[model samples]
Target chain A: MKRFSWDEMMNRYPAFFAIILLVVALTINFILQPNMFARDTLNSNMRVFLPIILLSVGQAIVILGGGIDISVGGIVSIVNTILATQVGLNGSPEKMWTFVFVSIGAGILAGAINGFFIAFLRLQPIITTYATSFLYVGFALFILPNPGGGIPAEIANVYRNTTPLGLPLAFYVIGVVLLVWMYIRSTRYGNYLYAVGGNAEAAYETAVPVTWVLFSTYVASGFMSALAGIAITMLSGSGNAEIGVPMTLTSITAVVIGGTALSGGVGGVAGPVVGAITLGIIQNIISFSRIDTWWETFVKASIIVVALAAPGIINLLRRKKV
Target chain B: MRKFSISPPVAAILLAIVLFLLSGFLPNGYGSDINVAIAQATNIVRLAVFLGVIAAGQTLVIISGFEGIDLSAGSVVTLTAILTYVTVKGEDDKVLLALLISLVVGALIGFVNGLGITFLKISPFVMTLGMSGVVTGLIIIINHGNVSGKVAPIMTRLIARPLSPDIPIPNAIIIWIIFGFLMWLLLERSTFGKHLFAIGVNRVTAKLSGVNVTATNLAVYTLAGALAGFGGFLVVGNTGVVFIALGQPFLFPSIAAVAVGGTLLSGGKGSYWGTMAGAIVLTLITSLLTTMQMPDSVRRMVLGATLLVMISIYGRQRGFRQ
Candidate 1:
C-alpha cells in the first residue's frame, strides 16, 4: 500500500481544499457571532443557504457532464413565479401541492428544451442556456408582473423552522441528495456521464450514450433547480421575476471554489455543497466584520477571485519548485 | 452562385427587413409613419453602434479560441464609465486624463484575467466571470454603492450630436463606422488575424505552425478590455450619465450579437460586419417590442425566443459543416 502524503491526498481528493475552507470560514464566523451554534441561528443560516447549495449541486453536475447551464436560474425563477402566482398566500394545502408538482414539471420542461437544443441540435451550451434564461425569466415576469404574492406565512415557517434529529432540515435534505447521488455514481449511467464529458467523440467510439448522458445531465439540473426554487420561495416567503438573476454566477463560483474543473468530467457534488456553505460563510464574515457596507461586495468578490485562482496558483508554484 | 450564397450578415439583413414590415402590422402601429420609421431606424442604428463597439471586442476574444468568452466586458464597461464620470467631473479639461485612465484601468484588469488564464491555467469563462465580480465590487466600494458626477460636454457632443434634421444620423454611427472599418482591416487583412483564426480552429495545429498562442491570447484579452473601456466612454457620451449598473445589460447582448452574427462560440469563424448587422437586427427587434408596449415580461420572452430561433438556425447550419 502507498503511504499517505499531503500533496498526493490533495491531488486525489478534489474536495480537500473546500473542506479546509469550510473549517476556516466556520471558525471566523463562530468567533464573530459567538452564539455560533444556537439552534435557531444555525437553522436560519442554513435555510437561507439551502437554495444556492441546491443550485450549486445542479451546476456541478452540468459542469461534470461537459456542459454549463446558465438557464438554471431561469428555471428557478419560473418555478418561483408559478408557485407565487398559482398558489397564492391564502391558497389551500392542496393547491400548494399541485403547484409544487407543476413547478417541477415547469423546471423539467425548461431543462428538456435546453437539452433538446444543446445535446441533439448541437448548439453551444452557453449560448443556448443564455437564451433560454431570458425565455424563462420573461415567462416568469409574464406570470407575475411584479414581485409579490407568496406561499402563506405558515408554509414559509415550516421550511424556515423545520428540524429533524435536532439538525436543520437542510442537512437532512442534503444527506438524502448525497446518498442518492452516491447511488447514481455507482451506476453505469454515472460512468457514462464522466466518459461523455471527458471526450464525447471518444465516449461515442467506446459505445457510451453520449447524447443521452448530455441530455440527462441538463434534465437533472432542471430538477434540482426546481427544488432550489421551492426552497428559495419558502425562504423569502415571496417571489420576484429577478430573484434568480444573481444566483447563476454564484453557483458557478461555488463550483470553481469547490475545485470542480470547468474542463469537465472531474468533480463531485459534495465539494460544491461545501463550497456553497463556504460562500455563505464569507458573506456572513463580511456582515459580521462590520466593515463599510460599500466594501462588502468588493471584499466578497476579491475573496472569490482569490479562491478561484488558488488552485492554478498552487499548480504554478509546484511547477516552479520542480 | 457560391459568391452570392446567403451569408449570416445577409440573413440578418433579411430578417430585419421582414421584422420591419411586421412591425408595421403591429397592433399599435408604432413604426408605420415613414418619418417615425426613419427616426426609429436612426435610433436603432445609434443603439446598435454602442452594442457593435462592445461586441467588436467580444468577436476578437471569441475568435481567439480555446472555448474563449469574455463575460467581464460589461462590468469593465461599467467600471470604466464610473471612473470616467468621477475623473472628468463634468470638466472639459479632465476628459483626456479620464480617457487615458479608463483605458489603462481596463487593460490592467484584462491583463490580470489573461495572466490567470495563461499562467495560472484558469478557464476563460471562470476567469472573466470572477474578474467581472471583482470589477463590479470595486466600483461599488469606490462609489459607496451610489454613483455621482456628470459626463464631459465635449464627449457628449461628439457621440450624441445629430448630423442633420432630415438625415437624423448620430455622430455615434459615424464613429462606429470608422472603428468597425479598422477592426475589419485588422481581423481580415493582417497576418495576426489569420494566426488568431488558426489558433481558434485548432490550437495544436496553430502551435505546430509557430503561432505564439500564449502572447496572442494575452493580447486578445487585453484588446477586449481596452475596447470595453472605449465603449464605456461612448456610453457616457450617449447617455450623458453613469449609474452603478450602467453596463449590466450589455453582457448578454454582446455575446448574443456575436452569435447571431455567425461567430461560432466554438471559435475560428465569424466577421465584424456580420456582428454589426446582428447588433442592428437586435436593436430593431427591441424597438419593435418597445413600440408594442408589451410588458417587460413579454419583451424578455420575445427576445429570448428570437435568439433561440436564430441560434437554432445557425446551430443546424454549423452542424452540417462539422
Candidate 2:
C-alpha cells in the first residue's frame, strides 16, 4: 500500500490547498464579524457570491477541458439583457420562466459559436472568445442600451429572501451543481474531458472525441454563465450590459485560487466553489477589519497577489530546503 | 526554401486599406473627399499609435511563450500615468524625472511578475492578473479613487499636436514610427529576440540549447512593463488629465491588435510591424463604425463579427499531426 503524504494529497487533489486556504479565510472572517454565520448575513453573502461561484464552475470545466471561455461574462450580459427586455418588470412569472429558458438557449447558441471556431475551425480559444465577447455584450447593449429594465420585484425577492430548510437558496443550487458534477465525473465523457485536456494529441490518438469534448466544454461554460447572469439579475433586480465584464477576470481568479491549473486537466469544480466563497470571505474580512476605506482595494489586491504567488513560493522554499 | 507569402503585416495593411475605402461609401465618412480622407486617415493613425506601442510589449511577451501574457499591462499603464502625473505636477522641467520614475515603477512591477512566474513557477496569466489587482488597489490608495493631475505642456505638444505648421502629422506619429522601427529591429536583429522566439517555441528545447530561460523571461516581462508604463506616460500627455481606470479601455484592444497583427497567441512567432498594422486596422474599423452613426450595440456586434471572421480566415491553427 502507498503511504499518504501532504505533497501526495495535494498532487492527487489540488483542491486540498484551496480548502485549507478557505478555512483560514473563513476563520479570519469569523473573527472579524461574529454574526457571519447568522442566517441573514449568510444568505446575503451567499447571494452575492453565487454569481462568481457559478461562473467559476463553468470556467473550471472549460479549463479542465484544455480551453478557456473569456466570453462567459459577455454571455452573462446577453442573458441578463434578454431577461430584462423580454420579461419586463411587469411580466408574469410564466413569462419570466419562458425567458429564462430562452436565455439559456441563447447562451448555448453563443457557446456553440465559440465552439465552432475553436473546435471545428481550430481558432485559438483566447482570441476566439475575446472577439465573441464583444458580439455578446454588443447584442446585450442593443437590447437594453440604457441598463434600466428589470424583472418584477416579487421575483427578485424570491431570489433575495429564499432560504430552504434554514439554508440559503444558493446552498441548494450549489448542492445540485456538485451532485451533477459528481455524476458527470463518473461518466466516460468526463474521462474523455480529462484526457483531452491533459494531452489533446494523445487523446485524439486514443480515439477520444476531442472536438466534441472541447465544443461541449465551451457550451457548458456558456450554460453556467447564463445561470450566473440570472442569479445576479435576480439579486440586483436590474440589468446592465457592463455588469458581467469584471466578473470574467474574477471568475478566472477564483478558479486559479481553487487550485485549478490554467494549463488544463487538473483540479475540479469543488475547489473553485470553495475559492469563490473564500474570495467573498476575504472581502468580508477586509470590510469588517475597520481598515481605512482607501486601503481596501490595495489590501484585497495584495492578498490576492500573495495567494497567487504563495504556492510557487512554498515550492521554491521546499526545493531549497531539500 | 521558404515559400512566397504576403506575410501578416502586409496582409493587415491591405485589409486596412480595404476597410478604409469601404468606409468612404458610408454617409458622413471621410472617403467622399480626398483631403478629408487623408486627414481622417492621419487621425486614425495617430489614435493607433497608442495601441501599437502597448501591443509591442504584448508581441514580445507572446513571442516568449510558456503561455506568456501580460494581463497587468493595462493596470501598469494606469499606475504609471498616475505616477507620472504626481511626479511631473504639470511642470515641463520635471517631465524627464517623471518618465524615469514611470519606467522604473513599471519595470519593478514586471520584475515582481517575472519572479513569481519564472522562479516561483506561477503561471504568467495568474501572476499578471493578481498583479493587476494589486496595481489597481495601489492606485485607489494613492488617489482615494480620485485622480487629479495635469500633464506637462511639452507632453501635450508632443502627443496631441502636430510637429510643425507645415507638418500635418502629429509628433506622436513620428515618435511611434521611430519606436516601431526600433522594436522591429530588436525583434528581428537582436540575440535576445532569437532566444525569446526559441523559448516560446519550446522551453525545454531552448533550455537544452543553453538559453537562460529564467533571465530571458524576466527581462522580457520587465521590458513589457516598461513599455506599458511609457504608454501610460503618452496617454497622460494626450489626455492632459489623470483619472482612475484610465487604462481600462486599452487592455482588450492591445491583445486584439496583437492577434490581428498575425502574432500567434500561443507564442513562438510574431512581429511588431504586424502589430502596428493591426492597430491601424482596428482603429479604422472603429472609425468606420462611428461614422456610420450606428448605435453602440450594433457597432460592437459588427466589430465582434469582423474579428471572428478575420481570425477564422487567417488565424486557424494547424492540426496536431501536420
Candidate 3:
C-alpha cells in the first residue's frame, strides 16, 4: 500500500472528475460545431460567464476555508440593484463611480457581518450564510423594486463593444481576476485557509490567526461578488431583483464542477473557470439542439446532477480499489 | 422533558409569540389584523409542512453518523408530487394509490443517494446535491414545467381549499401534524430509531457494536426521500401547481429547520420535535411579518434577521462529539 499525498488523492476525486468532463464537453462542442469556437461567440459567452466565474471563484475561497456562502447571489443582487438605481437614475457618471465604490463597500460590510457571526460568534457557516442571503437580497429589493434602472450607454459599450489587442475586454477582466487569485494564493492567509480546512485543530495548534483569515476570505468573496454585480449592470444595462437568483445555484454548481472539493481543501480557479464556460455552453447546446423550451430546465438539471455525481463515483472507484 | 425540558426551538416559539404580541401594540401595528395573518400563515404552514416533513428524515439521516444533509430533498419532493399528480389525477379513489407511488419514488431516490454516499462512500454534500438536481429535473421533464392535473376532489377539498379559504388551515398543516407524530414515534421509540441515533453519534462506535452502518444509511436517505416525497404531496396540494421552481424554496427552509432546532450539521445529536418547533417558530414569525404593511424587501429582511437571531442562540454548539 503506497501512502498517497492529499494532492494525489484529490486529483482522483469527483471534483477533478467533473473538471475532466467539462473539458470533454468543450472538446465535443468544438469538434461537433466548429463555429462555436469562433472568437466572437466565445467572447460573448465569456461576457455572460464573467460574473459567474468571479462568483464561483469567490465562493470556492470560502468553501476552501471550510465554509459556504449562499449569500453570494443575494449580494450580487443587492449590488446590481444599487448600481442600476444609482448609476441609471440619480448619479452622474462620477457619482456612479462613487455608487460603485459604495455598493462594493456595502458588500464588504455585509460580508464582514457574515464573517462576524460565523467566525467570531461561531455560527455554522451554512446557516449564517443562508440567513444573510435573504438579508442582502431583501435589501436589494428595498432599493430597486423593478429592473427599470439602467447603466449608461458608455458603460454598456465597455462590456459590449470593447476589446484590447483583439481580445474581448471580458477576457481581460478574467485575466485580472486570475491575477488576483494568484496573489491570494501567495498570501500567508491563503496557507492558513488551506490549513484551516485540511485540519482546523492542527492549524489552531500552530496558533494561526484562524479567525482573521476566515474573516478576510469572506471579505474578499464579497468584493468579488460586488464586482461581479457591477459588471452585470454594465452587461445587462438593467438591474432586476430576479437577475441573479439563478446564480446562487449556478455558482455552486460551477465551483463543484470546477473540481473544487466540497470538503474544502483542494482545487482552484482554473477548474471553475472551465466549469462556468462548460455550463454556459450547455445552455447553448440546448438551444441549438432545438430541444423543446420545455425540456431546458430538465436537461440543465440532468446535466447538473451528472456533473455533480461523476466526481463522487470516480473517487469511490479509486478509493475502493474496485 | 424534565431533564431535557426546553429546546432552542421552544424558545424561538415563545419569542415569536412575544413578538407577535408586541407587533399588535406597536404604533400602526398590524399584527392584530387577524384574517390577513391567517391567510399569510397558511402559505408558510404549507411550506413549513413540506420542510418539516423533510427535516424529519434529515433528523434521522443526521442521527445516523453520516453528516447526511440531504440537499436532494426538494428534488425528491418534486418527484413525488409529479408522480402523485400524474398517477392520481383527480381520482379520489386513486389518491392513496398515488401516495403509494410517491413512496416508491422516494425509496428509489433515497436508494440512489444511499448508494452514492454510503455504498460508494461519496461525501454527503456533493452526492445529495447531485441527486437533488436530478430529481428536480425529472419533475420538470415529467410536467414540462406545466401545472397539470387536479388533486383528487377530496384531496383538494381536504387539503388545498383550506379552511373556508378565508380561514384556511392549509391541508399541509394537517399532514404536518399527523406525520410529525408518526416521525416522533419512529425516531424516539423504535429499535430502528435507536440504531440511527447510535450510528449518528459515532459510526465507528456503532459499527463496533454490530450496527449495520450501510443499512442505517440506506434507511435514513430512503426515509428522507419518502418524507420529501410526501412533502411533494403537500406542496402541490398547497400551491395547486407544479413548475420547475416550486420545490426550490423548500430546500433552505428544510435545512433551516434542522439547523435552527439545534441539530448539529455534523451527524448525530438532534430532536425532531425541536425541528417541528422551529418550523412553528418560522411560521409564526412569517405570519407576524404579514400583519405589517412593509415593503417586500423589508419583510424579507426582518424575516431573515429573525432566523439569524434564532440560529445564533440555538445553533451555537452541538452534542455531536465529533
* Best-matching candidate per TM-score: 2
**lDDT of each residue in A93-136, candidate 2, tens digit only:** 99999999999899889888999899999999999999999999
Ordered by TM-score, highest first, the candidates read: 2, 1, 3
Better of 1 and 3 by DockQ: 1
Kindly report which residue pairs in candidate 3 clash with one another: A14-A311, B64-B200, B65-B200, B72-B132, B163-B169
DockQ leader: 2
Worst 10 residues of 3 chain A by lDDT: A9-18
What is the lDDT, from 0 to 100, of the residue B253 in candidate 3?
Answer: 80
Comparing candidate 2 with candidate 3, which one achieves the higher lDDT?
2
Residue B45 C-alpha lDDT in model 3: 58
- Tens-digit lDDT track for model 1 on B107-202? 888888889888888899989998898898888877784667888888887789876666668889989889988998889999889888998999
lDDT of 2 by residue, B1-322 (tens): 9877667778889999988888788767765689998988899999999888888888899889888899999999989999999888879999999999988998999899888889878888889989988898888888885766678888898899999989799999999999998997898899998999999999999999999988999999999999999999998888878888799788888988989889999999998988999999998898788878899999999999989988887798987656
Interface RMSD of each: 1.8, 1.0, 3.0
Better of 1 and 2 by DockQ: 2
What are the TM values for chain B, all candidates? 0.94, 0.96, 0.86
Candidate 1 DockQ vs. native: 0.69
